[model samples]
Target chain A: MDDTTARHTEKMRRIKAARDEMMKTKTEEKGLIIVNTGKGKGKSSAGFGMIMRCIAHQMPCAVVQFIKGARATGEATFLRERFVDECRLFVTGEGFTWETQDRDRDIAAAQNGWEIAKAQILDPDIQFVLLDEINIALRNDYLDIDEVVDFLLTQKPHMTHVCLTGRNAKPELIEAADLVTEMTLLKHPFRDGVKAQKGVEF
Target chain B: MDDTTARHTEKMRRIKAARDEMMKTKTEEKGLIIVNTGKGKGKSSAGFGMIMRCIAHQMPCAVVQFIKGARATGEATFLRERFVDECRLFVTGEGFTWETQDRDRDIAAAQNGWEIAKAQILDPDIQFVLLDEINIALRNDYLDIDEVVDFLLTQKPHMTHVCLTGRNAKPELIEAADLVTEMTLLKHPFRDGVKAQKGVEF
Candidate 1:
């Protein structure tokens, strides 16, 4: 074989090898977890992307936003109305923890959300779970980080993927996560005294 | 009557209103396609629980399985491997087109294998495209269907999801797919006598 032909043959060999690996990798379920943190926008947005991917593939998923509390955002409104039956889209909200003032009540609400989340995470029907703003809740003691990590690890071998988002992710949580992505904040409209943009921030 | 209780009540109302409309409709992008038909099981198993739910969350999803891919099995393996990436998986493969066959190729070969499959359906980054069984080489006029579909569609929105798998799916081409799933039948070990398992065959 000449140069091009030789290259083509070599490429084919590599391709077959890779295909074999892929087949092997795909045979068993691989669980995943992504922690989206740091002070920035779009953590939840990233989670939303995963949700959409799962729906397109016909996988069942669930989403629970702790601090968000159903804020009438365009995304929540759209998904709740149309795709709920097809996918598991749930928004259990108690509003922002700091704003609520009743620390005990806030903790209780977080616990409640955690319970719901716990059930879904373990449910075999649920392939991916987006815990929107979960990091913040864990930081504030609204939810226990240790418990969350424990559940994640226990569920890991089952092929369940989880995405945890929000600011102030604890060091332990970051270490425990399979993929920890910190969305650094270089600048923001909020810092410029501009209010959160509609369709951008809840 | 105190100020604290009054503020809490107001916040509660706001949260409720936001969530009530969670049932409202939202915008959607172009639909996607998922093909999970094949002699092997787990085609739908792979697609249904991962990428499908992602779209269900308003990511814009459309799934078309050429064969009856949605017979739910108590043991679902394909859908569980999606915790790491959601918007990246799209499934489209029909185990085999029963209607097409010829003596030249008993099983899908290079014409349909790595060659046409690569030329046709393998664009890992494309938003959505699933070629389930372009593997039926000479049987289904290998290379033709794969090339045509690859040439036709536009890959965009960056978050499109697709899935494909099945027996005789061209190897070379299927390799190019962002994600590929193959159901290797193990110990259906049913001796020529036993009936097929229910919830196992869809």
Candidate 2:
């Protein structure tokens, strides 16, 4: 074999060996509680993406929107129309906290949303549950972090995955989660005076 | 009006006024150069989500895979099968960097991949272009950062959005980008001894 082919072969062999070694210990499979939080865009977008991933796998999925539920979003509209059979979406929030301006009302709405999410979390048929913007509810003290954690710990079905998305995730929830991603702000067009557009931001 | 109804009405009026004021300033529409980078997962997955968003809008899209192209991924397989008319997926990498090992070959592959990407970026018919893992090629010095930035700045179609996904995005690229999200590592299942599963990781 030529020098290049021989080098590539040797390198791939090393990679395979290392990957095999890593795989040897990676045997556990269980439900994953994934949290997407931080002060940046795409947290909810990523969570929505996971719902699509679930659909691609032919898994039944449910989306429970906590904030930004007063009006329909492009994602909710599209998913409902396109993947009607495989997905169930619940928009339970009255509106954004700032819009509601009533703590008791927000808390009540959050409690109602959590009830929907809890039912999905416990459902064996639903393999992926997206609690979109639920972090904002948790941040606003609309839902008790301890209560949410206890429910997640106790209610999630085996092999089911739950994704929570929003900014300022609670420390307790972060600690309890199996996977967490902090979408850090780098640069945004809003800083440049750009508006949120359909098919992009929503 | 009842006390709670009157309060909610006042709050919603205030919100509508603020929203209208914000909407007044958001008028410009142009293609965005989006960057998803940093040491975290979901960058490429998020990009793929954008591709889906484009597809939902009935817009043509293309994905140019830079690194993880040695094998067929679930995203590629599903998209190719389902959205055959609306999406174009190009897997142009020989393999991951460690698996390839040869600097010269990697550079050549990156150069070739960039050529494909350049064509897609300039295509007016393609509304969304996802450069999957292109940042790794840039980080490895396989493609000249300045050249890539200049091309992105100069040759991009007026209405085509480009999303670059990977870790270690160059400062020059970030400066030129319209939107940037850094996916910070919070917690990962791989660290807890879980293998990359078929539908989830790919």
Candidate 3:
């Protein structure tokens, strides 16, 4: 081979070798759980980004949105309409508690959402299961944190990842999570008395 | 009823109506794909129960097993594996192509695995990208489909998922798929292959 050809071949070989090492490292990586809490917007959005990242890798995922009822935001609506069977999406509960102050009813709604979430979370097939707004529900007493934690711990080890989002995350939930993120509320449109805009908050 | 009880009752009634109207319809559900193609025995076994059925209730689905990776002894494995990700795993492609000669390597081996796969199929965030029994590197020319497909497409689309399993799935892949399955065929331990194992071959 000519000198130029030889030089190019060496460079290509080195690049391929480096890439091979990187691919091996990535394949060996394990799944994880992320908790996005604190008073702020985009906590769920951040979690959604992670979800997108996994999907890019063809990882099957499930999202169980707790305590978010009939108010169809942009994310829930798109997921519900587009995510298909590969990534399971469940939106349960009766909106926020303030909107529906019936403790008994809220608890029932929470239980219903939890029932679906329990099955998804325990399933080893799911790479990641997003329990959107779960942290807030636990703090508000809509769902029992003790039971939820117990269920999470008992799931089949490995092959299943979990993500929890929402505000007022209890200390216990944060402690149990693998990766905890606090989305501190700096400022939001709601502060200016403006309602949620389409495609942004939803 | 007391004033508070009456108010709570009315609130629940409203919530119920909203939930009823917001319930997702069957046609509105998203679709998923699960492939059980590989040279190993457990490709289907691992995939069937893991992801297919977990999202069954959340949405409708279909399964296409590209090839019968295993013989006839793994029926139970297939049956049990048909949990969360079942409906999506369809067995098509004609049992392990390596045993046949039609298998040709149209693509180059050195090229990244993700590059070729990205050239055609676009949705990497697909709920499940199950490419069963796809390892033909040793048997045929290395086309590197796995690397290409997994790299460009195997992304976690806003809750989408993907899973791949096989004996020879290349380590240096183009796609850093979210979930990957590697089915190992241990000692057959059978005496000269006495009539193949039942429920295990399919």
| TM-score of each model, paired residue for residue | 0.47, 0.89, 0.45
Candidate 3 residue-wise lDDT at B186: 22
Who wins the DockQ comparison? 2
Give the worst 10-residue stretch by lDDT in candidate 1 chain A.
A191-200
* Candidate 3 structure quality by residue, lDDT tens digits, A1-202: 6675466556656666775565454433334445666554445655664554444445677888877776765555545655576578887877776567576777777788889887887777777788888876788677888887777766635646677778787777766655555543323333233333232334
**DockQ for the candidate 1 complex?**
0.04
Stretch of 10 with least lDDT, candidate 3 chain B: B191-200
Better candidate by TM-score, 1 or 3: 1
| CAPRI level of candidate 3 | incorrect
lDDT of 3 at A145: 86
Ranking by DockQ: 2, 1, 3
Off by over 4 Å in 2: A1-16, A100-105, B1-23, B102-105
- Model 2, A54-166: lDDT tens digits are 77777888999998887667777778778888899899998787676666788899999999999998888888899999999898788999999988887777688898989
Off by over 4 Å in 3: A1-28, B1-202
Q: Note the Cα lDDT for every prediction shown.
A: 0.51, 0.84, 0.50
Which wins on lDDT, candidate 1 or candidate 3? Answer: 1
Highest lDDT among the candidates is held by which one?
Answer: 2
Q: Write the per-residue lDDT of candidate 1 for residues B153-195, one digit (tens) a residue.
A: 4432334434443456554444343323333332222222223
Question: Candidates ranked by lDDT, best first?
Answer: 2, 1, 3
- Model 2, B1-202: lDDT tens digits are 6787678668867887898788788877778999999887678777877776777777788999998888777677767777788899898998887776676788899999999999998887888899999999999889999999999899898777899999999999999999999999889998888767644566
